[model samples]
Target: MMRVKHGSFNHVEVVEEMIFAINVGYKVNDLCTRCSTSQLSQSRRFPFLRPVRFLTDSRDVLWIMDTSEPQIDGPDPSPAVDHGLLAELESLRQSHQSLRSRSAEMEETLLLAQRQREDCVNEIANMSKIIESLCSERDRLASRVGELEELLKEKEDKFLSKFEEELIERESMRVEIEVYKKKFESVEEEMEERGGLLSRSMEAVQTVKDGLIKVIQNVDDDKIPETLGDENGGNGDLRLDSEFMPVFEQIMEVRKLVDLADSKVSEYKEMKGKEKRQLENSVVSLTEENRDISSLLRVALMEKEAVEKSLNKLKGNTEQKRVALLQFAERGLQRVGFGFMMGSGGSIEQPMVESYGASSTGSKSDGSECEEEVVSLASTVEKIMKNLRLEITQLRRCLDESRSDNERLESLTTKQAQQISENSLYIKELEERERLLAQNIEELLVDIKETETEVDRWREACELEVVAGKNEVEERDKVVTILQQELEKTKSALEISNGKLKLKADLAAAAMAAQATAEKSLQLADSRATGLRERIEELTRQLEEADSRERSGRRSIMRICWPWRAFIKVNAGNGAAPRFPNVRRMLPEMQSLLHSRV
Candidate 1:
C-alpha cells in the first residue's frame, strides 16, 4: 500500500492490481494481476490488527487496500481460473438432498409391507380353524360308519346261528316221518293174516251147519235114535265115544286163543296214544323255528340296507374332506415351507391312500341284496398325503430375488451418506475462516478508539500552551509602556542636569529584549496547535475505516447464524456473543454437561 494526498480528505480504500494510480506516478499493472490467493498483508499498515484472509477463496484476484479513492469494482476474479470450484459444490448439495428424500420413501414402503404381512398371518389363522372343523366332521362320519358295520355283522351272526338250529330240527323230523310209515305197513300185514284165519273158520262152520240141518230134518221121532247111533258111527261103539271127546278139547282151545287176542289189542291202543303225543310235539317245535328264522331274516335285511346307505354317506364325506384340504393348503408360501401346507394342483384324496385304496361292497352284482353281509370300515386312520416339492421351490426363488434387491439398495444408501459427510467437513473449515475475520475487525476497532482519545488529550494540551503565550505578550506590552514613561522623565531632568541621560537609555534596551522573546513564544504556540489538529483528523479517518469493516461483518452475521444458532443456544444463551471453538475439545465438555443435566 502507498499513501497519497488529495484535497483535505484522508481515508483508506481498496484498489485492484489491474488499475494504475495516475496522480501518484505509480503503475500497479506490473503487479501480479492473477493473485495466487484471496488474502494479503494488511498488517503492514495496521499493526494493532492480526493478519486474516478474505471471507472465502472462490475469488481469483487479490485483496488490495488504497488510501486514495474507493474503487468502483468489488473483489473481481482472474480470467484464468474461470468459474472455480463453486459449481462442483452446488451439484453435491443437490444429490445429498435427493438421497434424504429417497430414504424417507423406503421407510414408507417397509411400513406397507409389514401391514400386508399381518393380514396374511390373520388369514392363515382362519384357515387353520377351518381345517380343524373339517377334521372333526370327518372323525364323526367315520365313527358312524363303524357302528353300522358292527350292527350288520351282529345281524349276520344271529341269522347263521338260527339257520343252523332249524336245519338240525328238520333232519330229526324227517327220520320220525320214515318210522311212522314202517309201523303202518306192519299193522296192515297183521290185519291181512287175521282176515285169512276168520275166512277159514267160516268155511268149516258152514259145512258143520249143513250136516246138523240134515240130521235134524231127517231125524224126526223115528230117525232121531238111529241118526244119533249112526253119527256116533259107532257112537254106540267105543270108537265113536272117543271121537266126541276130542271135539270138546278143540272147543276149549279156541276160547283160550280169543282171550289172548283181547289182551294184545289193549297193549296196541296204549302204544298208539304215546306215538300221537310225540308227533304233535315235533310239529310244534318246527313251526316255532320257522317263525324265529323269518323274523331274523327280516331284521338282517333292514340292517344290511342301513349299512349300505351309511357306507355311501361316508364315501361322500371323504370326498368333501379331501377337497377342503386342497383349498386350504394353497396359500402364501413362507421360506422353507416347513411351518405350513404346500401342495401342487393335483392334491391328494382319500382314495389314493394305502389304507383306503380298496373299495367297499356289501353284495355281488347278481346276488340278492338281502343276502349281503355288512361292509367293513376302519375309523382310526389318516387317508390323504399331498406332495409339495414344486411349490416350495417357487417360494424359495422369490425370496432370493427380494433379498438381492434389498442388499443393493442398502449399499447405495451408505455411499450417499459418505458423500454428504465429506461435504460437511469442508463447510466446517469455511466457518473457521469467518471467525478469524471477525476477531481481527474487533481488534482494529479497539485500537482506533484508543487513538481518538489520545488525540483529544493532545489538542487540549496545545490550547493551554497558546493561552499562556497570549498572557506573556500582554505583560510585555505593559512593561514597555512603563519604560517609555520613565525615559521621558529622564530626558526632562537631563536638561536640568545632562549627566542622568545614560541611565534612562539602558532601561529602554532591557524592555525591547523582553518584547522580542514574547513574540517568539507566540509563534511556537501556533505551530504546536496546527500539529495537534492534523493528528485528530488522522485518528477520525482510521475510526471511519473500522466502522465500515464492522458494518460488513454485521451483514454476514445474519446469514451465518443459521448453521450455528442451535449450537450457540445450547452452549451459551442468546444474549451472549456466539463463540466458535475447536469442536473436538468442546464436544467432550458439552457431552459431560448434558449428561450431568440429564
Candidate 2:
C-alpha cells in the first residue's frame, strides 16, 4: 500500500511478474483525496493498454480481472500513464510479491487447523478409557450393598424365632399350677371331717376308766383282785365290740392319710415356690430380652430406613445423570461449541460473491472498477478468516476448560473412593459387633433352656418325697440371670453397632452421591471431549473440502492464465514460461505436512 514514487530511477527491469494490481485496490481506500468514504474505488494509475483478464491463485482469492485502461493521450492527462516502462514494471513486480505472501498465509492457517484436529482426537480416546473403568467400579459397589442387605435380613429372622420359642415354654408352666391348687383343697376337707369323730370317742373312754378306779379304792387291799377284775371286764367287753375295732383301725388309717397329706402339702409348697422363682426368672429374662434386643432391633430398623433413603437418593442422582447425558448427546455441538465456528464461517459466503461475473463483463474504464470490486472481495475474505480464527481460539479454550473439568472430576473420584473405603471399614466393624452380639444371645438362650430343665427335675423330686435343696435351683437362676446381663450388654453393644452402621451407611451414601456427581462430571467431560473430537473431525472435513475447492479455483485461474501465458511467450525472446506463482509444485509439501500431522 506504499505510495509509488513520482520520479524514481528509470531502466527498471521487468521479468514477466506484472498485472497483479487489480485486486490491490484495497490499498488505495485512503490514498485518493476525492475517494468516497462510503465505497471503495480502484487505482487508475497502473498502465494497461486494453481489457485484460487475470486469474486468482489457490488461496480462494477472487480473480478473473478486467485490466483494460484509457488511452495514454486523453483529454484529462494523468501522471500515472507517463511512467517509463521500467518504473511500471517495478511496481508490478511489487504487487506480484504481495500476492504470493497472502497465499502463503492462508496455507499456514489451514495447516494449523489440521494440527488442532489431531490433538482433539487424541484427547477423546484417553477420556473414554477412563470413563469405562469408573463405570465398572460403580457396579462393584452396588453389588456389595445388596449382599449386606440380604445378610441383615437373615439375622433378624433367626432372632425372632428364638424369642417365640421362649414364649411357648412360659405358657406350659401355667397349666401345672392350676392342678396343684385343686388337690390342696381336697386335703383340707378330709382333715375337718375326721377330727370331730375322734374327739367324741376319746371323752367316753375317759369316763369309764375313772369309774373303775373309784371302785378299786373302796375295796382296799382285800378287794384288789375284784377291782382288777372289774377294770378288765369293761376293757374286754369294749375290745370285743365291732365298732371299737373299726374305730381303732379307722384312727390308724386317718393318721396314715394325714401323714401322706402333710407330705403332699410340703411337696406342693416346694413346687409352688419353685414355680414362683421360675416365673420371676422368666420375667427377668423377658425384660432383658425385650430391653436389649428390642432396642437393637429399633436401631437396625433405623439403619435400614437410612439405607433405603440413601438408595432413593442415589436413584434420583442417577436418573438426573441419565437425563443430562441424553441432553448432552442431543445438543452437544451447541452446548460445547462443536458447530459454533462452523456456523459463522458458513455465513461468510454471502450474496456479494455472486457479483464477480457481472463485474468482469462490465465495460472497461481504466480498469479501476474491477480492481475496486476485487479489493472489496479481498477485505471480506480477510474479515471472515479473522472471525474463523477467533472461533478456533474459542474452541481451543473450551478444550482447555473441559480438560480442567476432567482434572477436577478425577480429584472428586479419588475423594469419593477414599470415603467408600472408610465406609467399608466402618461396615466391617459393625458386622463384627453384630456377630459378637449374636453369639452372646445364642449362649444365653442355651443357659435358659438348661435352667428350665433343672427346675422341672427339682419339682419332680419334691413330689416323690425325696428332699432336694432349693439353693441349687436358685444358684442356677443366678447364673441364668448373669448370662442375661451379659446378653443385655451384648444387646446394647449391638445397638451401638447398629447406630455406627447407620452413620457409616449414611456416609457411604453421601460418598456414593458424590461418586455419582463425579460420574456425571466425567460423563460431561467425556461428551465434551467427544464433541471436540467431532468438531475437529468436521473442521478437518471442511479443510479438505476447502482444499478441493482451492484446487478447482486454481485450475480455473490457470484456464484464464493459459492465453496470458501464450501472450507472454510471444513477447519473450527466450520462448519459455514464467516460474513464479506456481502452487502446483507446493502440493507435494502440503500433503507431506498433512501426513505428518495425521
Candidate 3:
C-alpha cells in the first residue's frame, strides 16, 4: 500500500498519479496474458498483477488498484525475459517517467496558484489600509472646514458689530446736526434783534441831531434880535451871552457824545458783520462735513451689503459642498458594500454570517470599525450642517437689521441734506439783507459826515456873529453915555433961561417922546433876554438827556458785545450759537422808545 500525505500533493495530482498507475497495471495485465499463452511456466512464475491500494493520509480513504491476475506465492523466476515482455516493460518505464514529469509540472502549477492567492490577500490588505487613510484624511478635512466655518461666523459677528456701531455714530451725528441747526436758528434770531436795535438807535440819534439843529437855529435867531436891541438891551445882551456860553459848551459836548456813539455803532456793525460771516462759514463747513459723513455712511452701507452678499455666496457654496460631500460619502458607502449590507437586511446578514465563518475575526473587526467611523462622521457632519444653518439664519437676520438701519440712516441723511439746503438758502437771504443793510449804513454814515460839516460851519458862523454882536453892544453903550450927558446939559439951560419958556417946553416934549421910546425898547429887550435864558435852559436839558441816552445805549451795546464774545468762544468749541434772552426782550422796548422819540 502507498500512502499520500495531504500537504505533499493536491487532489488533482493524486488522481492523475492514480490514473497513470492504473494504466501501468493494465499494460502489465496485457503482458501477463500474452506471456501466459506463450509460456505457461513463465506465466505461472510471474502471476498476473493484483490491484494496488492507495491510502490517503487524513481521509484514510483506500483506493484499490485492479489487476488482470491474482497474486501467487512462487519460487524465483528465470532472469531471462522475452522480447515482447521487455518491450512492454520498457514502454511502461517511459510512461512512468512521463507521469513523474507531469506530476512535477502539476506541483509547480499548484504552488503558483497558492502564491497568487497570497498576493491577492496582500493587495486587499493594502487597499483596506489606503481606504482607512483616505477616511482619516476626509475626517481631518471636515474638521478643517468646520474650523473655517467657525472663523467665518466670528468674522461675520465682528462685522455686524462694527456696522451697528457705525449706525450709532451716524445717529449721533444726526443729532448733533440737528442741534447745530437749532443753534443757527437761535443765532439768526439774535442777529435780527440786534439789527433792529441798531436801526432804532440810529433813528434815535437822528432825531436827537434834528433837535440839536433846531436849538442851534433858535439861538441864531435870538442873537439877531439881541444885536438890534436899545441901549438898555446891552446889559441884557451881556447876560444872554453869559448864559448862551454854557449852552454852546453843552452843544459841543453833545456833538462829541453823538460822534462817540456813531463810532461805537459803526464798530458794532462791523463786528456783527464779521460774526455773521464767521457764522455763515461755520455753517457751510458743517454742511460739508455732514455731506462727507453721509457719503461715508453710504460707502460703509455699500460695503456691508457687499459683505452680506459675499457671505451669502459663501453660505451657498458651503451648502453645495456639504451636499456634494454627503453624496460622495453615500457613494463611497455604496462602493464599500455598506449600502448593500444595510439594504439587504436579513439576506445580507446570512452572507455576512457565511463570510464571518470563512473570514478571520480581524476582518469582522475592521468592518465594524469602518461602520462606526462612518456613523460618527455622518453625525458630525449633520451637526456641522445644523450649525451652519443656524449661522446662516443669524447672518440673514443681521442683514435684515442692517438694511433697516441703513434705510433709517438714508432717511436721516436725506433730511439732513434738506435742512442744510434750507439753511444755506436762509443764509443767502441773510447775506442779501446784510448787503442792503450795509448799503443803508454807508448812506447813513455819509449823511452823518455831511451833517457834521454843516454843524461845524454853523458853529463858526455863530462864533463870528457873537463877536460882531459884542462890538455892536460896546458901540451902543458909548452912545447911551453920550445921550445921558447931553440930557443933563439941556436941563441946566432950561433952569437958567426962564425967557425961552416955549423952547424949553419943546425940548421937554421931545425928551419925553425919546424917554417913552427908550422905555419901550427896554421892555422889548427884557422880554428877549427872558426868552433867550429859557431857550438856553431848554437846550442844556436836552443835551443832558441826549448824553444819558447815549450812555445807556453804550451800556446796552457793551452787554450785547459780552454775550457775543461768549457766543464766539462757545461756537469755536462746539459750533453752537449763543442765546441772549434778556437782550432780545430789551430790544423791543428800545425800539418803542426810539419810535416815540422819532
Candidate of highest TM-score: 3
By lDDT, the better pick of 2 and 3 is 3
Note the Cα lDDT for every prediction shown: 0.39, 0.47, 0.51
C-alpha RMSD of candidate 1: 89.2
Model 3: per-residue Cα lDDT over 1-598, one tens digit each: 4554434665444444444544554445334434444554344655544323333333433445444554456644456655656777788778768767866765675476457536534644553454355345445534544554464456446545745675676578557656655655665554555443233123223434543444444433333122222323333433445423433333345546544554554565466457557545644654564465445445534543554454355445435544754564354334333454356557534544654565555446644643453354344334434654565576456545544544554454454445445544544554454455455545644654564455456444443333333333334444655776798899788777865887889999999999999999999999999999999999999999999999999989987644445544555777444433345555676645534543
- Candidate 3 least-lDDT 10 residues: 222-231
| Model 3 CA deviation exceeding 4 Å by range | 1-8, 42-83, 185-598
lDDT tens digits, residue span 1-598, model 2:
1222212311110100121333233222212212221121244443343233333443333333344566475444355534543465577567676645644543464456456546544544543454455445445544554564565556456556755675565556545545544544553454454344434344333333333333223222223233233323444445535434444444334334444554554565467457557545644654563455345445434543554454355445445544653453344224222353356434323322433333332322323554555454455445444654576577657656655654555554455555455555655655565556556555655766565465455344333221111122223344666787899999999999999999999999999999999999999999999999999999999999999999999889876644335444544745355433343544666545534543
Model 3 whole-model lDDT (C-alpha atoms): 0.51
Among residues 3 or more apart in sequence or in different chains, the pairs in candidate 3 whose N, CA or C atoms overlap within 3 Å are 51-65, 52-65
Q: What is the lDDT of candidate 1?
A: 0.39
Q: For each candidate, give its TM-score against the true structure.
A: 0.19, 0.25, 0.27
Error of 3 at 289 (Å): 43
lDDT, model 2: 0.47
**Model 1 regions lying over 4 Å from their true place:** 1-86, 97-105, 108-112, 178-598
